[model samples]
Every structure is written in structure tokens, then in C-alpha cells.
Target: MHFDGSTWWMFYDGTSRGRRHVGLATSADGRSFTRHPRNPLVLDAGAVDVQRVGGVWVMLRESGTGTLWSTSPDGLCWVDRGRLFGLSGASTDRFGQVTPHLQVVDGVPSAIWFGGASVVSWNRNRIAVAYPDGAPAPAGSGCTACVSAGLSCAAACQSALGATGGACGMPGSTDGSRCCACAPEGCERCIGASADCHAACVSAGAAGGWCATPGSTDGSRCCACW
Candidate 1:
């Protein structure tokens, strides 16, 4: 499905026999959709939703492990991004299927779960936002409002500078409105410049951008445009 901030759309295979691959459809209302083609839009994947991200691909396909166990620019591709962290291990499903958990807080994507084999070795479902020292704290518990959402106000401020062509490590914060305009890194814009950034933290035509990211100031970790 595609979410342009207002409408939700998708490509699905209607209920039938031997139905393989994707089909196109659009919806003004999320439930009912108009199918574009009766045949598969893109075929040859093992499962219907082998893997997919909302707004990053023309179609979906499941490649292999180590391909992208985590988030990347597009939900389909993963590579060198400015952000990196110590992923202790894949967060697993309660039944032990290795289904990790991910969420987007504020505007940054964060993974929260017990390092199963770590010191505590907890065996229960858990959800919390990240902390400055890389610890996990309950949501709404962080250095600032944005921090509670998994993004530091400093990163938010840096976003403001980047949007305006300022350099890193400078006093660049989102303008008075907390808008992190999509500009060059270390870029300098007015203190209150607007964040023309996509809801997922990238520009329209830039290379390597996150699409429909997780986490929100509202406490719902959904895949957002930024």
C-alpha cells in the first residue's frame, strides 16, 4: 500500500486459486479498492508479502538474509547511511520466530527489545524508546520531547541546519516551529525555517532516504514519510 499522508493504497491478489504475485489497486477509503490489472503486477516471489515497505518500491520481493535485517533508505534496499548503531541481535517474536520489533519515535527509527541472551535475559514482550546512553526507557522518558520519540533535539536542530546548507556540530535547530527543513548537512537556515523534509527524513530526489519510517511524537511507531 502507499500512504501519501492522506490516502492509503495497495497492490493485492484477490482471493482465488493459484493466485501468485502482486496486483494494482487504489482506494479513497482504505477498505474498498479499485483493481488496476487482473494479472500479477510483479511475479515470482515465494510469498504474497514476502517483504515490502509502503512507499519505497515499484513492487515487492524477498531477497535473502543479511540483505537488510534493519531499515534503510527504501524498505527494499539497505546500505551505508549516516546512522549506525550496535544491534545486539534480532528482536524475536514471543513464540521465538526471530521476528524483531521496530518503532519510529518522533522522526527517527528505533529498535527496542531485550538482548535475550544479555545480562537480564528477559523473556517477555517489551517496548520502550532509546536513551542518551543507548539504554531503553519507557516511552515519554527521555531528555526532551523529541528524545522521547527516539530523536534528540540536537539531531532535530542539526536537521534544521542541514536543510539550510549549514555544517554539522553547529547551532542549527529547527526553527521556532520545530521544523527540520530538508537541506544540506551543516546547511544553515533561519532559526525558524520549515522542515520541507519528507516525513521519513529525506528529500524528494535525494539518494539513500528512509521511506515511511517508524516512531512518532504521538507514541505510535508507524512507517511515516518523515
Candidate 2:
């Protein structure tokens, strides 16, 4: 909850039809409150945190899949800024981040969230941090072959592995000729395979495919087939 001089605003989560939503309420005396006409300001969002940053309002929420960020000029109308962070591709946080909180330390803004290895296992999770600029990339980020082919780390992972998104394992990573990390889906990772990736896919009964990570003689590579 925050106060804008005269009106106190509160953002909360509510469930309707088995789905979570973000709601807004306002109070004049910090006691009696009224719900905004747009009660559920956002759909499929929960665990909201709103704060005044510089001259605008920043809102962070967990969308189950990942954490999302938004900004508002008056705290009433919000503009989504997309996913707060990308998958690190680590066994600890391979899925995504959730339950986000925005904190400013030494004049630098950062996002804190919880990441778990699996979607259902929360007992053994890790707290992760992400900055406005970016976060540190994880180890073995993505296919080295794809990165060598002049693709952004994230793009390499996404296009090569057919993943939802990707992240790099290092800072100041450029778009071309840099390796990143990605969670593979609808793809197969081959270790110590020297055969042609496309032929291997065809041999495996795929209609057509490409070597997501090519040019590896004795290492892990991936084959993406359609």
C-alpha cells in the first residue's frame, strides 16, 4: 500500500474462476477503502509489489510462469515491461523466477525472486537477483556452436533448442558470436556425436531438422527437428 498525498492506494490479489488477478483499492483516511471500478486490474498476476520509483510507479508481480514488471505514471494505468528475467538454465533455477520484489540498494534497483529446479518442488529453491541492466550468466550457458554462428546468446538458445527463452552465462555479452544458456524443449541433446546433425535427425525419423549446436567433434550438441 502507498499514499499519494491524499489517497491511499492498495494492490492485492484475488481469485476468480480458478484464476488469480490483481485488484486495486483506494482509501481517503487509510481506514475506509473502496475498490476501484477495475477491481481486477490485471489477470493471471499475483504477489504484487508496487513502489514509487523516480517519477513513476513500478509494479512487480508473479505470473506462475515468470516474474513480470510494469510501470505506471499515476499508479492507475500500468504498462507492462515484459518478463523481469530469463531462465538461467541451471539445475537450480532452470524453470523461471517467481514471487518478485523490487529493492533499491545504493541507488541501484534490483529484482529479487525465488527459483526452483522443478515447477512443483519449492522446498529446495534458491533466491535469485536481477538488475535493470542484466544479470550474471550461468555456466555452460547454451550451445557453443550456435553462439559461434553469429547469434545472440539468447537467440541462439531459443532458436537452437526451441526453448521459450534464453540467458547468457556472462556479463557484457554481445548479440553475435556469444554463447548463452537455454532450457531445451522439443529438441534432443547429443553427446560425443560426430555424425551430421540433419542426417541424424532424419535417421531418427524426423521430417527435417538442423544442428542447433554444430561443429562439435567430442562434446554435447543438439538437433532440432520439425
Candidate 3:
């Protein structure tokens, strides 16, 4: 569940009709929500998690041995963005990352998932946290009213900056009103700005990284090559 200022968005894993899928609902009070007419927001995908980064809304769903990701303009509709992360340790080598969640600590986006040694570590779940390399933290928190649900302001800000723009995390863009150029150095959840974040990526070894926004063409996006 995530709070988008005025409305609360709740995503759940359940069965509808005869198929197992993910569902969504919106509510003003956080208790009652109007189900989206387009039910089964995701098909055959489970362990769903949703987050808003820069000005984009991203959905992470488990697919095969890795996690599949998608971006949405409105949480109701989605477009595939492919795999976001994969696990390689002995415990999670087989199952990949499971039940991942995104949170912005201080400013960098953080990813937390459940992993452990295959059957040998059965029932012994290990919690892993992934984030940008240089992220400073208040540890698991972000400004609530920073970014809007549709991210209109972020889109506009990025559009105004054009290509070769710096990330929102650069210096003064974290008001949630503008989008980042690429993802920050240690962001596990959010996308960073291109000028700064990309530099960080290159410094981190993704010299030829490719960065783009997922849903909208506004240019407010994250770096994938990194």
C-alpha cells in the first residue's frame, strides 16, 4: 500500500475469476477503495510491488527466475519495462528476488527482498537491501507530498530541461516537483537524473549506460544500463 497524498493506492495479490493475478484499488480513507475496472493489473505475475520514482510509476512483478518490471502513467494501466533486478547468491540463486519492496531513505531509493539458501535454507529467510552506492539515509523514509501520483510537475520539469539534463538528486530537485535525470548513486527504488546520476553510474562502472523514462516520453527517467 502507498499513499499518494489525496488518495491511497492498495495493491494486492489474489485470485480473480479462475486466474491468479494482482489487483488494485483506490481509496480516500485507506479502507474503502474503488476497484479499477481493469482488474488483474498483472497476469501470471506474483509478489508485486509498486513505487513512484522521479516522475514515473514502476511496478515490479516476479517472472520466471527474475523480477519483471513495468511502468505506469496511471497505476491503473501499465507497460512492460522488463526485468529490474536478479539475485545470484546460493540462497536466492534459484528463486531470484522475492517479495521486493521499494522505499526512499533520505533520498536514495532502496530495494528490500526476501532471499535464502534454496531448500537447504528452507524457512530461513534472509532480508537483503539494495541501494545506490553513496546513498545517505534516514533509513526508509521519503517526503510524502514530494511527488504527485501522475507526476505532472516532474514531467514538466524534465521536459523543460530537455536531454542531457541532470538528475533530480543533483542538488535541489528532490522537492518531488521535478524528476531526476538518471537514478542516484545508491537508489534502490527511484530513477536518477542523467547528468549527475549517469556520471555516478559511469563512476560505478556503467560507462555506456542507457537512461530513459519508462511510461511517458517527458524525459524524466531512470538509467537501465547502470
Best by TM-score: 2
**TM-score between candidate 3 and the true structure:** 0.51
lDDT of 3 by residue, 1-226 (tens): 8887899989887875665687888899988889878888877767788888766788776544656788888887789888776654333334466666767555446644544222222232344445545543322223223433322233334345433223344333455434344322342234334343344355556544444543433323554543
Ranking of predictions according to TM-score:
2, 3, 1
CA lDDT of every candidate: 0.34, 0.61, 0.55
What's the C-alpha lDDT at position 133 in model 3? 52
- Where does model 3 exceed 4 Å of error? 16-19, 120-124, 133-226
lDDT of 2 at 153: 54
Flag regions of model 1 displaced more than 4 Å: 11-20, 38-102, 112-226
lDDT of each residue in 1-226, candidate 1, tens digit only: 5655675656454435654545566677788877764445444332223223443332222222211132334422433222223332333211221222334355444442222211111223223222335546544422343322444444445443433122223234323344332234221121124232222223323222221222223312222332
Model 1 clashing-pair count: 29
Each prediction's number of clashing residue pairs: 29, 6, 22
lDDT value for candidate 2?
Answer: 0.61
lDDT of 2 by residue, 139-222 (tens): 333354336432345445544655544667654554444446564332234622422354455566655455676444332346
TM-score of 2: 0.52
